[model samples]
Target: MISAPHKSSGKTLVSLGVMYNLVQEGFSVNSFKKGPDYIDPMWHRLVTGSQCRNLDPFLMGAGNCLDSFISNSDEKSFSLIEGNHGLHDGMDVDGADSSAGLAELLETPVVLVVDSQKMNRGAAAIVKGMQSMPPKACIKGVILNRLQGARQEEKQRSAIERFCGVPVLGAIPKDDALAITERQLGLTTIDETADAETIIRNVGEKIASCCDLQAIRSLFSQAPPLKTSQVKAERKAIASVSIGVFMDPAFCFYYPENLEALAKNGAELVFINALEDASLPDVDGLYLGGGFPESFLRELSGNRSLLRDVREAARSGIPLYAECGGLIYLCSAAHYEGETYPLANVFPFEMGFQNKPVGHGYLDMKSVCDSPWFAKGERIRAHEFHYSKPFDSSEIDAYQFEVLRGFGVTGKRDGVLRGNLFASFAHLHAVANPGWARRFVALASDYKVKGRCAV
Candidate 1:
């Protein structure tokens, strides 16, 4: 496990570097992120050439987290779990759902990445505290990042090893070139960053030269064998349905498990580029995942034909599911920086961008009305992170979900329903909600059988 005292401590860069280096050395690396994130996994996938799965205990539960880790890490030469935020930071006061807790559950040895910019022996104190804290992770090694000179590195390394009683595996020098650009969401997506590969290669080379790969591999070997279920559930066969997925730079925030679940339930995924595609494809259902549609406002708004096609599909009883950015795309228009960009207009509402996050973090919602996707009174555990909200509040009561926790479309409700279309700001994961893919596939199959009848 690669973790740190806090966020922005250069652990992500270290993870990417270590993974890339190992992959280059002919080791198959399986990566997992410890939260509901789509961006970091993109970089991980780019480096390892495999899907980076998420292991969120709060959203997916501890049992699911263990099962997922065991299943995905099986038969792989190397398994790396990257922690989010601080090792002990979590929604729970007891830190039961933090990355340290996850490390303890999996019995994985953690490599602490400490930012040694303004401190010398203080880095050791932080490491010792993290090691001694309740729900203590098996912190076996430490990596001093962003060091200035040999004197600074010597001071930190000696202090950490002497006090924390852990090996100083690496002391990475401070280099701005190794950093990935941050945005309102987080790191820039691999699709939009043209030099993403170059950055990964550079960071990997730097890590290979500085870090002790042999020691890192030794720690990985110390993890105890996890007891995983050998039995795989048999999937019931269903009529295959093509589901169009918006997968371009404008819409790329899809969880890998979500797509895999859809395929397992017999749905053929057809990728669609919302920014470039002139028209919709011949698919039974359309999936629009979360992404930065706000970034390409002019281009998306200028794509008049595609917008009209999407609106037609929604009106024609075609099963359409959209999250966050997808919800924005399906709206009438978006107001940003005093400019209005026309969108699909599936629902008669306009979206407006805010300086701060309008809806962020975990969400608990109960279905108020029956929709093609979710049943009435169904409880949903999902998450939302967005800066955009509906400009017009007249459609507040038209939603399907009664928000119990976190902000939704409004402070009260979310999950706007129109015909067979369901749009929301909350993003769902298939591992947590096993019925999501099944129900979505069933909905699409029903639509396919009934044909495109106008609602």
Candidate 2:
């Protein structure tokens, strides 16, 4: 497990560099992300060319999360688990579901990534506290990031090793050129960055020179073997339906397992670029996942022809499902920076934003929509993080889910309903909720048979 002192401490950069280096050593690597983030896993996929599965204990429970990890893992290939935020930080005060807690559950050794910008012995104290906790966090090694000079690196490395009794595996110098850009959500996707292959190659080469590759590989080798059931096997697709997905950089927040679930349920996904595409493809249903639509408001609004096509698709009874940014894209207009940009204009409400996060957490809800995806009162668990909201609150009175454990679209409910369209801020994981993909495929099958949804 690759963990950090806190968020933005370059844990992801370390993981990326290390994984790329490992792959260059002729090792087939499988990657796992600790949280519900989409962008980081995308980078991991770009480096490894394999699906980076998500393992969220809070969402899937400790046992199930481990099972998912093992089930999705390969015993032959090297596995790297990239944790979120700090090693011991979690959703609640108790830190029950932290990355450290997850390491304990899996009995996996951890490699802590530290930013040594203004830190020295203080780093030892932090890792020592983490090591001395009642339930030890099994922090094995350290990777110092952003070290300035050779003198500073020697002192920082000596203090952390002598005081904390852990090895300092590597020290990366401060390089502004290595910095990745960010928007409202987080790092820009690998798809957006230029010369991505060369960038990843350089990262790998640097890490291979700085860090001890053999030691990192040895850490994962010591972990318990992946169970027979945990190892995935080839399965033939069983369902037959075409599903159109808004799959460009603007709508690129899908979990790898989610796509796997849809494929297992026999879905043939047609990826559509919302920014440049002028019309929806001939498909049974449409899926719009989450991304930074606000950043490209001008481009989205200018694509009037695509918007009209989407609006017509909904009217024609296409089974359309949308998440956070997708919800905003389907609305009449979005308000940002004192301007209104027209989108699909399918919904009556206008989307607006808050200066801060309007809703962010694990969402617990019960379905109230009489739709094909869920029976009335079906419970669902999903991840939610958004700053945008609907301007008209009462307009969502007929939404599909009653929010049981989150600040939904209106604090009490989410999942807007309009004929065959369902839009919301909650992002569901397909692995944790396979029923979601199954139901989606069933709906798509129905729509494919009739060329319209059955009201």
Candidate 3:
């Protein structure tokens, strides 16, 4: 397992670089993400040319972690598990539920990615504490990132090795070329980023030069043999349906597993851009994932043609599903910075930016209304992270459909679902709730077959 002291220490780049170099060296490598991140795994998949699965112990349980890891290992000789946030960062008191805890549970060896630019000997202290803390947390080696130069790199490397008693597996130089463009959600999705292949190759070259690729590969060989199973249950034939997926840079938050699940359950996906595209694709359903739509509110709002097209489609009974940024886009108006912009207006609501109402963390959703997304009384676990809040309570009340877990937007209420539109602030991973994609596809299938919305 690879972990960092904090976010943006080049963990993903280092992991992907190492994986790509290994694949180039003639090794069939598999990759797994530690938490609910969908963006990093896209780079992993691009580098390794394999489907990367997420292993969140909190959401999917410890058993599913091992299951997901083992199942994806069927076609590869080695597996790389990239962790999220900091090493010991988690949602529990005392950091007991952190990624380090999960590493201990899985008995996996961790390589610490330390940002060596700011600290000389202090970096060593952090590494030593991580290595010595709870000996059960098997931190094997350290990778010194953001090295200034040869002299600075040598000083930091020697300091870490001498003080921390851990081998410096790598020392990555400060290279602006290796930096990936990022917005609110995370790194720009591979699909939207230009020259993706060149970027990956450049990153891989830098990582290979700095890191001990051979040592990293050796660690993967130490992973215990994984077990596997197969279910022969026949897949139900889903009626023909097409789903319009928001794919522009502003709204590109989606789990690959989610899209795969929808396809596997028999729904064709049509990609559309919210920034440049003028109309939604001809489809039975529309899916608007999450991204930094607020930053592009002016551009999105100015695209009157696209906004009108989406509103018309929703009115025509097209099943529309949106999350976070997507939810904001469907609102009647969105207030950002100091200006207000008219949105799709599919839902009778307006959103305003707020400093105190920033929503974050895991959520449990309970369905209050029978909608195409979920059956009445169904409970689903999802993550919610945003800074905007609904401004008009009366308007929100007109379309409110689901309630959250005893918080924000009281008893039996959170998401806004009206007619064929299901919009929510919470973002979901299909693996967390395997039934979501199927239900979405089923609804779309119903609309396609009958020429009318399912709900």
Candidate 4:
């Protein structure tokens, strides 16, 4: 388990760098993230060529944490877990369940990353505290990040080694290019950055040079082999339906497992461009995953033909599944940066930006009415993180749905799902709830069979 004293302390960069270098050295490495982060894992996947699974104790139970880790592991040589937030920070009154807690639970050794820019010997105190905080939490070594020069690097390295009683595994020089970009959503989605691969590779080399790769690899030597139940094949083929997946830079927040599950269950995945594509791809279903659609609202709205195609598709009763940013695009209009742009009017709602009512966090939802995505009375667990809300109540009335847990406009349960449309502020990770993929494929297949029969 790789951790740091605080956020943006180069844990993610270091993780990627280490993983990349290891892979280049021809070692089979698997990657995992500590929390419900979709973007960071994307980078890890790009570098290691393996899907990075999320392990969040709060959203998922402790059992889920172990299950997800074991399920995704292969016959790889080692598994690297990139932690979230500060080592001892989590969502609890007494901070009982932080990333450090997760490391302890998994019995994974913690490689503490210390950002040693300002202080000299003071860095030792921080590392000493982290090492002593939980005796059970195994802190293997320390990596000094943002070291100035050879002289300063040596000084900081010696100070940490002498005072902290831990070997300084690495010392990374301060480089602005090493930092990843960020937007309102989170780190800029991989689709938006043209040089993402190059950036990741360069960052990897820097990390490889600074850090002790041999020592880090040894940590994984004795890790217990991962075990998981083999996925049983479905007795019957799920209906085969065509699903139009939004693939532009603005709408690329889908979990790979979600799409993979859909295809495995017999759904045809068709790629669509919301920014430049003229018309929607012919399909029985439409899926718009989350991203910063607001940033590209002008380009999206300017693609009038695509909007017209979606509006027509929805009118024809094509099953549509849109989340957060995608939901914003389905509304009558999106108000972003002091301009209102027309959108695919699948629902009558109009989304307006607001400082208040920022919906966020783990959500537990139960279907109040029967829908294609979920049956009536079905309970689903997901998460929500957004800042936009429906501007008009009348528009929300046009759609029918309720939120069970989280900040929805009307009450605790507020999301607009009407007809075959499933629009909500929640962002779901498919691995956490494999049923989401099954249900999505099932819905798409049903539509395909119905369409074929009608034709």
- Say which candidate scores most in lDDT: 1
lDDT of 3: 0.78
- Give the distance in Å from residue 360's predicted Cα in candidate 4 to where it truly belongs: 3.5
Residue range 144-251, candidate 3, lDDT tens digits: 888877887777778888987778899898888888898566788787788888998998898888889888767765655443455234364553778889888788
- Model 4 bad stretches (over 4 Å): 93-97, 132-135, 148-164, 225-239, 355-357, 364-370, 375-379, 398-405, 409-411, 452-455
Per-residue error at 304 for model 3, in Å? 3.7
lDDT of 1 by residue, 1-57 (tens): 999999999989999999998999899999999988999999999999999999998
| Candidate 4 lowest-lDDT run of ten | 225-234
Task: State each model's CA lDDT, in order.
Answer: 0.91, 0.84, 0.78, 0.78
* Cα shift from native, residue 280, model 3 (Å): 3.5
Question: Candidate 2 — which residues are off by over 4 angstroms?
Answer: 92-94, 226-235, 368-370, 453-455
Ranking of all predicted structures according to TM-score, beginning with the best and ending with the worst? 1, 2, 4, 3
Instruction: Report the C-alpha lDDT of model 2 over 244-315, residue by residue, as the tens digit.
Output: 999887898988777777888899989999999988788988999999898789999998988998888888
Q: Model 2 lDDT vs. the true structure?
A: 0.84
Over 1-455, each residue of candidate 4 has an lDDT whose tens digit, in order, gives 88999988989898988888889989878888887678898888899887877788776767767776666665655789998888987776544457887887777888999888887878888888887775246788899898777887787778788887778888898898888898655677677778999999998889888788888878776555444456444454453677889987788777666787677767878898888889887798888888778779889989888898888877777778888888888888988778999888777868898764477676767677766676677666667777888877564553334566676544455556666777777776665666777777776667766662211
Work out the TM-score per prediction.
0.97, 0.93, 0.85, 0.87
- Candidate 2's clash total is 1
- Residue 372 C-alpha lDDT in model 1: 69
